[model samples]
Structure formats: structure tokens, C-alpha cells
Target: MTHPFDLSVVDRWSDERTFDVTPDAVHAYADAVGGPSPVFAVVPAMDLVFAVAETAAPADLRTRVVHGQQDLVLHKPLPVGEKVTVRAAVVGLHGKRSGTTATILVRTRDAVGDPLNEQYVTEFYRGVPTDLSVGVAAPRLPSEPPAGPPSAEAAHHLQHDLPSRYADASGDHNPIHLDDEVARAAGLPGVIVHGLASLAIAARTVLAAAGAEEARLARLSCRFTRPIAPGDTLTTRVWADGAGYRFDGLDGSGATVLGAGVAELRA
Candidate 1:
């Protein structure tokens, strides 16, 4: 069933949550996705990811859910010392294989109600589904022309906490990415990187793409597409476009891990 929604009501929510921004927090997020370290991005990302899940709608989720895809777009990089409110609405839903798989559309705006970002999140939660035991992506979509070679250097490669250091970085006590026993219970191979952690890397990539010099950079946004495992190597890519630039987060294998990454330039 298509979830018909009033774009207006969703925008003007009866309930709203306020987040006081800290430049440190925003930068930390960006740093995670920027250069790799012990794995800081996962920690910060977990905080936002689950919170966003709740904010989107409690009634729409289930205990068996998994994050299939997530993305963040930005009119501006979330600056420090700004209090922003994320107004999220379920804009669309569709069933491809009779509820075996689907997409959840959500858009979050800044405190003043300006469009901060749009997310095209797809969740696959159903049975009799196609086999994906290998965690390899299934093929779909028409082929597009190859992208031009990236003009910018990789600039940064970051590694957040391995399974060991995640706790100290982001306060996410999620056992799936840290504790081996807990990961077993969750049926995970081992510790996985936090989704937000990966997003943080992407954010930093955007900033770099805008310009390595802090003075020349503008705003940034990202959309999280897939999860980054703890041992994975994160590669940042940027292209020098017109006013700003385009940036993205990629795993070591040269895969497009996140889709719809954006960044703007300063005057």
C-alpha cells in the first residue's frame, strides 16, 4: 500500500525535537567520514541513525528491521553553535515484491524550516526474498555513462575505532560493532562500523571537495547508502565542479558506498 501523506502536515509536525548544535559535534561527524582513524564515524552515526528512525515514526518500525540504505543531503553543512530541528515525514512507500521489499522516503529540515536535507531510504524487510547470503548487492537499474575521472586527490583516508575503540569515540554502546559475543547473537560476522560513522566520513569528504582551505568551503550534505564494516578501508572522492563541488564516501574496493553526496562553496 502506498502511504499517502499530506506534505503540509508532515512538515508542520505536532511534535518536534530540537538539537543544539556544537561545532565540535558537527566537525566530529565530518571527521569520521573524512580521514579514517579508529572508527569514530560509526559511533556518531549510530546516535543519529536510531534517533532519526524514532523521529520518522515509532509505529512504522519493527524489531526485525535492518538498515538497508540511508542518505543525507544538505543545503548547508550543519554548523556549530546552531540549534536545528529535524522535521521528518514519511513522504512515500512502495512494495516491489508484495511487501518483501520497499523504500521509505523522509525529508528533514533545519530549525527555521528550510530544506536541510532529503533522504531516500530503502528498507528491505520481508520473506521469500531473493537470496543475498553473500552480502553482495543485487543488480538493477539502467547503466549510466561512466563518471569523469576525479580531479581531486583522495586528500584523506580515515579509520575510526576498530572493534576496540568505538566506545571511547561516540558513546554508542551497540554490541554489534564492538563486542564479539553480542555480534554473534546478532548474527553478524564480527564488529561492523556504525552507519553514522560512515556518514561522518562522507561529510568530511564533502568539506574537502568544497576546498581544503576552511575559508573557501560552504555547506554540505550526504545520503547513507550502505554499512561500512570495521575493517573496511574508506576512500573519499571529490570532483571540482562549478560553484562548489561533488563529493562521496567509498569503501576500499572502489564501490559507491553512499549516493547523492553534495557540497557548496563559499564566496
Candidate 2:
């Protein structure tokens, strides 16, 4: 079947923008995600990685797509109160039985044109069919969990206002995260926490557990397994794996929220 939208834009969809790493932006992210230290002191990873949202994309498709996965490789911590260039392009479009997934490659560079990080954001358009599989897929996480007990474990409470707070800080004002009605209309239970917000929280906990500084984070990746609503308690478990770590997060109901998580620290 022919795809409803143009598939020719696969490798051609590119966007670029400048992002300011303001002190306020950094602080706000820290407040929302529960950290002004470790993984959040220099800059919340999500604030820099999710800068792809500032890039242009098809407006119509935005409403239909849901964040599927994220893979971020950090070169260095972004400097606060400075500007960085963010460039993005649609690198892959693959069709599954239920939908099509678009893989976007986002690159962040310092003001001097030095590389800072590269992130792959995958969006799944449910019920949208496209048979074409083009370009490169995002990096995959480890298939199996490490055996035995977790090396570190921590839990965080998702405050009722966390969604709004994160929205204000991250510039992601999607109603599904702040409006219960809108979320229900979109087929969600109610107002849910932003996936990146939850991911950021998990990263902070993992880093603190490892006793590593924020700047040491070299790569982070995870698959969003389920929606995490405000007021939910998130428990993250991490296992040491050589130079990196593998982790998983569960919500209050013991349902997995993030799976196949990978976080690596630079030696």
C-alpha cells in the first residue's frame, strides 16, 4: 500500500537551530528532575538531547507520533549560559505491523563548532503504514538483563506538579502531559509525565549511585515501555556492566516504565 505521506522526505528532512544554555534553563531542569548536582549540574541531559524538538518537522505528523525510543552519546557536557547549534535529520523510516517509526538524528555542537553530543530520537506513528525501510536505525540496547541483584537502586516520587514544572523548564508544553482531558482524548489514562523528564530522573539517580559526575556520562539510551503519570513513584535499578551500566525503571504499580536502559561513564 502507498503511504499517505511522502516517503521521499526520508533522508531529506533536515532542520537546524541554535539553543541557548541559559542558567535559568539549567536550574529549572535541575529543579524539575531533582538535581542541581551530578547528572544535572552542568546541564540536564534531556535539555540538550531533546533540543530536537526545537527543529522543524511536519506539523500534521507531530500529533500522530509518540516518542518510541532515545539514544544519546555525549562528547562533553554543554556549557551553561552559552549557545549551541542543534541540527537534525530524519535518518530512518521503518514500517512495523502496527505503525511506522521515524528515526531522527540530532547533533549538538558548541559555539566554536566542537561536537557535544549526538542523539537519536525515534517517533512511532500508530496506524500509519509505510512499507519503506530507509537509512539507519538507532542503536539498539542490550537484549538481556544482567544476572543477579542490581548494583544500585533508587526511587523518586513524581510530584503532582512535575508535569507542569517540567513543561515550563523544558519548553515542551504538550497538553497530554498537563491536561487530563487532553490525555484521555489521546487514549491515555490521564496526565502523564514527559518521557524525557522521567528518563532524566532515572539518569540522575543512576549517576549518583555510580558516584560519577555529570560530565562523565558518555552515552545514555532507553526504551520507553509505558506511560508514567504524575504522582507515580518511579524505582530505578541499575547493574554495573564493565565500563557501563544497564538499568530498568518501574512505576508504582510495578510495571516497567523504561527498559533496556544503558548508561556509560567516561573513564
Candidate 3:
């Protein structure tokens, strides 16, 4: 029997999607991720990634997919009210021990073709088997905290209602995030927060610590080390690393939940 996910879709670019960035949308995204500074005139960077992925996902494998990982590189801050074009393509596909992984590349450019940002998103489909041979690589991180004391640290209390609010704002109504029964069926303790939501909070902390304009963020990358339950307190610690920073996020129990985090700020 053929797999539900069509692995043959790999390496094909989807049709281009045009988006008009609006102030209201930006504000709503900021509110969903806990507010960012008013100085940011662009939409939250991750919003673009999600928007493109919405159009890029394969129709055949929509329901049982989960976001596995993400890496974002921003060329510049996307200005509100500007028209941008997004294109997505499948860049990599691998068969892992647990499931199949599909890596999608989304690139956004200005109306005039100036590059704005690029994102690589990995999605996992549980129980879907693939014959495609590919290797799995683990994310690299420092075994211990950097030599010096952390440059910055902040604690964020993830409210119980955050998942619902994020789901509404992000258009990701995955039952695993909203329905307790659905989560338990999937072997989770209960409704867990979205990994992107946690990344947003971590990004906010990095932006604040660098004291650089939010628009100047050039790159953000992290590995989701653990699932975050609603109402958990997240503590982010950052250390200076050249023109950027290396960071890690810990849950209330001091377990590192987001690791191998790196953020680059434009000079």
C-alpha cells in the first residue's frame, strides 16, 4: 500500500504567493507572542514563515502533520503595507526511525525582487514510512553555559489561555494544541503549547537583550528540546557571541527546553 504522504513531491517548488503586510496583522501577531516593542514597523518574522507554509503544505498530508523544526534567516525587516512574494519548495526529505521528515524552504522577496527572508521548516508525519534514504543529524550546542555570566535573563509565565490565543492568531488549530482528549490520544499529558509560540517568546528575549532594533535581527535558530505545557514558566538566558548571541531556554524545573539557540543582530 502507498503511504498517505506523497514523497514524490520532494524538490518541487509550489506556485508563488503574494502577501500584503498590514499593521493590524503585525500588532495581532505581537500580542499573540506577548507584545514586542512598538519600534518594530514590520510583521513578526515568524508570521511570514507560517503564512508561506500554509500555502505550501501538501493537500494529501494536512491533518497528521507536526512541525518538527525551523530555521529562519532575515535579510531585513519587512515593512508593513508592503507587497511581498513568497515561494516554497521541498528541499529535503528523510525517513527517520520514528517517522518521515519533510523539509520545506520558503523564501520571501520584496515587490521589486529584493530578498527579505528565508525559512527552512521541517514537518514530521507519524507512522508514515518512506523508502527515501536520508541521514538524521542532531543540533549542536555547547555542553555547558559559556565562560562568563549570562548577559541577560528573563522569565515569562505562559498563561493557560495562551495556546487558544496563539491558535486563533496563527491559524494553526491543530487539535493537539486545543483538545485535551486529542492530546492524550497522542500520548501527551495534556494540551501542549505550540513550539513556535515558545520560539516567539525566546525571540522576544533575544531582541531585548541585544538592545538592537527588532528589525535588525538577521537570523534565529533553535532546537525544540522538550514540550512545554501551558502555565509553565520559561526562563531564557543569553550570552554574547560576536555580533550575535547564543541562548537557551529552561522550563520551571530548570530543564533546557529550547537549546542550541543562536540569534544574529545586524551591526
TM-score of each: 0.59, 0.90, 0.83
Q: For model 1, how does the per-residue alpha-carbon lDDT over 145-201 read when each residue is reduced to its tens digit?
A: 226976564533435464344344465656666776766565556566765566555
Query: How does each model score on lDDT?
Result: 0.48, 0.78, 0.72
Query: Every model's Cα RMSD, please?
Result: 7.4, 3.0, 4.0
As a TM-score, model 1 comes out at 0.59
Q: By summed lDDT, which 10 consecutive residues of candidate 1 come out lowest? A: 133-142
Of 2 and 3, which scores higher on lDDT?
2
Rank ordering of all candidates by TM-score, starting from the highest: 2, 3, 1
- Residues 7-83, candidate 3: write the lDDT tens digits: 45555676677777777766776788798632132233344444444443456455556777667778877767888
Task: Score candidate 2 by lDDT.
Answer: 0.78
For residues 1-267, could you state the per-residue lDDT of candidate 2 as single tens digits?
Answer: 666554565565345567788888888888988875333322333443334433323556556667889888889887888898876667777887788877877777899999998888887877777686778889988788778999899999999999999888877778889899988877889999988888899998788778888788899889988999898899999999888888889999999999999999999
Runs of candidate 1 exceeding 4 Å displacement:
1-14, 23-64, 77-79, 98-122, 126-146, 155-175, 181-187, 212-226, 240-249, 253-256, 259-267
> Candidate 2: worst 10 consecutive residues by lDDT?
37-46
Quick one: how many clashes does candidate 2 have?
A: 0
Q: Select the stronger candidate by TM-score from 2 and 3.
A: 2
